[model samples]
Target: MAHETSETTAASSVDAAASSGRRFLRNKVPEVTVSFWIIKVLCTTVGKTAADLLGEKAGHGLTGVSVLMSVLLAVVLVVQFRTTAYRAGVYWSAVALISVVGTLISDSLTDGMGVPLETSATVFAIMLAAVYVVWYRRERTLSIHSIDTTGRESFYWLAVLLTISLSSATGDLVSERMDFGYWLSAVLFALLIAAIALAHFALDLDAVWSFWIAYVLTRPLGASFGDYLSQPTDDGGLGLGTVVTSVLFLGVVLGLVVYPAVTRKDVTQLHQAARQAA
Candidate 1:
């Protein structure tokens, strides 16, 4: 009887471990908050500055930079898709790379192919709208909270790519064509984002609408701030250079990712509470 009980207990433990692993893998989305937004903006700023530094300052040229970044983004995205759980470093690296690639796509269309900003902006907007319509039609919901399924994840990333591309073209058009300058453009987008937030919290806008609006606005806000810091004084910027801006933002993102990795305090606490209740 003692031997049989020991074997059964061991089997039960193994089964429990497997179950726990499966649950962990299924929790795909991160806990959204202020920290998430702050890091996202930092990544966007790095994306703009790093892409420009590589193409213009480092002599990589537009085609070379676009090709290289596009390949890199694809590799990172593959890694992200393969992972069963949310690894902050892998996920955020993919985001940063995609941001750069998205900006490059818009820049190449405008500078290399001579496509008008208005046209690029409109094309991206239509693409994004189509993505949402299809995503909703299939998934029946647009909540970030439930990104565990493969189809939802695909839609989420597609929308993200479109938003970045559209924002890049629109930001450039407003700052350059309208002569609003980088700082003013940043302020304008910030206020627009703030209003969206107000509408979500105070006026009870749909959660999906609030999330998408905020996501789109962050791109322009990040781009404007990036240009304000990196462009020359004659262009109404601080002339900090792309390398410095990239380094600063990259360092912050690395630190934030590392903190969550090492501590794992957030994950641990949540799991512990779940176990206690169970």
Candidate 2:
């Protein structure tokens, strides 16, 4: 009876480990797709204009708006993390809030505390690199496909936030400090993203790195694009105003998200490619 009991206990332990491992491998995020990129860029554009509108137009100082928006962001993120499966509404809401907070962080350092754009960009770049190093060291993979575990998801969100800050800083450095017109800056980043896509498709770039490179560049691209429409002609823009730009882009984002939500097209499946074997 004692021997039989010992065998059963060992088997149960094995079963439990297997179950945990399986759960850890199941992705809880959306799959990379065309819709993903479209929504990502649109949300990033909103990040730029919405932050400005809330801070300047909405009758709140940057600090006050940041605090209010941060509270709302916390609630949205809590819902996102508590979900067991990928949810388009929850996921995109989190992304949008991250975009807003990221803009606030970058702007606060530069406009609020007198940090130079170059300095902020360089600092954010280093911070992003550090996150990547620590993440890769612990998980041995930096691919977004394996963000099923709590630790990986945390790392993913941290990376996303850092990337947005870095991108915002860099965008301002090129488009404002350097005095490149908003339209020109938009063209510049669009070309850069095109190059990355070419490298991925034509030259056989690593899929994970390609995805991330494009992702980082889109931040600046969207910022420039947003500013081009929202800023006045005196500043080399289309003079649409923030209200129009925000409403237009957000409507598009809503449409794109609805399609994916109803179709379940972007939901990550139970078994997908992983970097572990590489």
Which one is best on lDDT? 2
Give per-residue CA lDDT, model 2, range 38-129, as digits (tens).
89999999989999889787677777888888898889888988886678899999998889999998998998889999999999999999
lDDT of 1 by residue, 1-278 (tens): 00111334434544565667744224344555666777888889998998888888657788888999889988988888887656788888988998998999999999999999999999999999999999999988776654656778888888888999999999999999888999999999999989988887778777668878888889889989999999999889999989888898899989877776676632322233334433
Per-prediction TM-score, please?
0.86, 0.88
Worst 10 residues of 1 by lDDT: 1-10
| CA lDDT of each prediction against the hidden true structure | 0.80, 0.83
lDDT of 2 at 139: 92
Worst 10 residues of 2 by lDDT: 1-10
TM-score of 1: 0.86
User: lDDT score of model 2?
Assistant: 0.83
Which residue runs of candidate 1 sit more than 4 Å off their true CA positions? 1-25, 262-278
On the 0 to 100 scale, the lDDT of residue 176 in model 1 is 93
